[model samples]
Target: MKPHRHSLYRTFANAAAGVVHAFKTERNMKIHAAAALMVFIAAALLQLDLIRWLFLLLAVGLVFTAELINTAIEAVVDLVSPQVHPYARIAKDTAAGAVLVAAIVAVGIGIGVFYEPIRGWIGSLL
Candidate 1:
């Protein structure tokens, strides 16, 4: 008998659960979650233009997605190799580096989107 396909809601629920799992299982994911929350809050507080908000959200999502993938890669690598191996180390490091690159790009995007607004706020406060 063929397995039943999940409904749309079930798929979305599973995806959300996986995201939560990623955040719980990965330290970097937790950090990314905190940063993403801050960016989201700042965006709302600053009342960013639609385009700017979209860009910020996209960047934040990219970083989070990259981190989740990195965590998955590391888990698979560890499961396959359990023992320390140079190739396994390389695989894990490469996955981590990809996440780092995504994070850096996100940070740059966040700065570009928020710098002027933040500076103006600081200026007003001084």
Candidate 2:
């Protein structure tokens, strides 16, 4: 029998598994994914330029990173406390707050990037 391979590929595979787990188990992640898909489709339909696309990608990355970190923090807090505790609550709340901040920033970026184009499209419909 052949032994298992250990390489950078394995590391990335494990990382992808974590992302899949998050998407499967987290409701917010699913929402984020749907929003991302919508943004990409809208961008394509609107013929958004490269710079705007880059900003949108950065916003998505920021939101996903914050969400994953928040999940990690919550898991660690739960593992350490396992019961109701003020510090655990504080830690979890802070992590969730970070996700909220990231999400808000992403919304700002999306509005900045898409608002004018969408507004123009709506005006053209009249």
Candidate 3:
């Protein structure tokens, strides 16, 4: 079979469609998106420096990337094994585990980035 090719615009559009689909269908995706929004709002309110912003952005990006990958893996596993199968269960579980790990790492980065600023803000209130 000849390899199908897509224009760059079409490629990005397709990717965007996948993101929309995930956001619409997956509860976890919505939760992650909400968390990201809150993080961005906090970053703005705190007036994070460039380095801190970069760290938060990277952490958030890592989480969304992991979630997207997990969504894709779950879809493929479901497609291949519509029936319950041991390997399919393992694949889905492992992908979920990866998402959990990414979220935990992001939380750690968030605390590290915001701790000093928040502490100072609280201190000033006293």
Candidate 4:
């Protein structure tokens, strides 16, 4: 006999719940959420062009997605290897590094996109 399989809707609902749980349980997800909100505000205040906004949103999405992937990787690694192991450590570290790289790139993009406008605003006041 085969084990029961969930319906499509049930699978989707489970996936959605996992995402919500990841957001709630993961500290980095909270940080990403905050950064995303900041980027949205900056986009509005800076009056970004459509193309700039698109790039900004894409960068933000990349960071968040990378973070989620990293969290999932860490969780699975922990589940599989509860005991301390060098390879498990390496796997988690590599996943974290990916997130870090994505975050750094996102920051670079944000600075590049917003710096000139922000500098001009300050220059006008000063």
Candidate 5:
């Protein structure tokens, strides 16, 4: 069936449904969401500068995008290859690797953003 052109609100609602579906179906997506929330809280508490906040946003967005793409890849792979196969394995593994790399990069960025404030806080407590 040809797709219908959705109204603006419906389009937004559909996008929100996709996000909810991902969070429901994908453990990694849920974890990324939690991490993102924590980062936002930290950024707020620390009153992170604009540059740092931008970096945090970029890192979080990358992870979210990577995870969504990974989910789509896995769903397509499963639909196309219902049985175990080497090529299917490769596709899923590669998609997972993309998420892993994004998560690692986000962690590195988080450290860069939080290190100084955290260290200073620790020093004050000592």
Candidate 6:
């Protein structure tokens, strides 16, 4: 069978819908979004250099991408194997692990980018 085709608008709308669904249903998505907001606020306050800003943006994107993929994997596993199964459990758990790894990397990037500015800001306050 030939593959189905979608209009550009439809493709974008579907992608947006997935993002909305994840944010609405996934607790982790909310936490990531909140953390991202705080990071941006701090970056603004600190006047991050362009390179640092790019790093922060990439880190945030990585976390978001990982989380979205994890959510998709969980949904597929649930649909394919609704009953409890070892393989299904493995699939879901590993997908979650990916998110954990991404979050850790993002944290490291945040610390690397923020450490100097935060330290200086604190020093100036004292």
Question: CA lDDT, every prediction?
Answer: 0.92, 0.94, 0.96, 0.90, 0.93, 0.97
* lDDT, model 4: 0.90
Give the number of the best model, judged by lDDT.
6
Q: What is the Cα-based lDDT of residue 21 in candidate 2?
A: 85
TM accuracy, model 6: 0.97
Q: What lDDT score is found at residue 23 in candidate 5?
A: 95
Q: Write the per-residue lDDT of candidate 2 for residues 1-126, one digit (tens) a residue.
A: 998778998889999998998899889999999999999999999999999999999999999999999888888998999999999999999999998999999999999999999999999999
Give a tens-digit lDDT track for model 6, residues 3-112.
Answer: 99999999999999999999999999999999999999999999999999999999999999999999999999999999999999999999999999999999999999
For model 2, what is the C-alpha lDDT against the true structure? 0.94
Instruction: Evaluate residue 4 in candidate 1 and report its C-alpha lDDT on the 0 to 100 scale.
Output: 93
Q: Rank the candidates by lDDT, best first.
A: 6, 3, 2, 5, 1, 4
Displacement of residue 5 (Cα, Å) in model 2 is 12
Q: How many residue pairs clash in each candidate at the backbone level? A: 0, 0, 0, 0, 0, 0
Write model 1 residue lDDT over 1-126, tens digit each, in one string.
Answer: 999999999999999998889978888888898998989999999888999999998998899888888888988998999999999999999999999999999999999999999999899999
Q: Which stretches of candidate 5 lie over 4 Å from their true place?
A: 1-9
RMSD to truth, every model? 2.1, 3.9, 0.8, 2.1, 2.0, 0.8
> Which 10 residues in a row give candidate 1 its minimum summed lDDT?
23-32
lDDT of 4 by residue, 1-126 (tens): 998999999999998887798789998889898988988897898788898898898898898888888988999999999999999999999999999999999999988888888999899899
Clashing pairs in 3: none
Worst 10 residues of 2 by lDDT: 3-12
Q: Ten residues in a row with the worst lDDT in model 6?
A: 41-50
TM-score of 1: 0.87
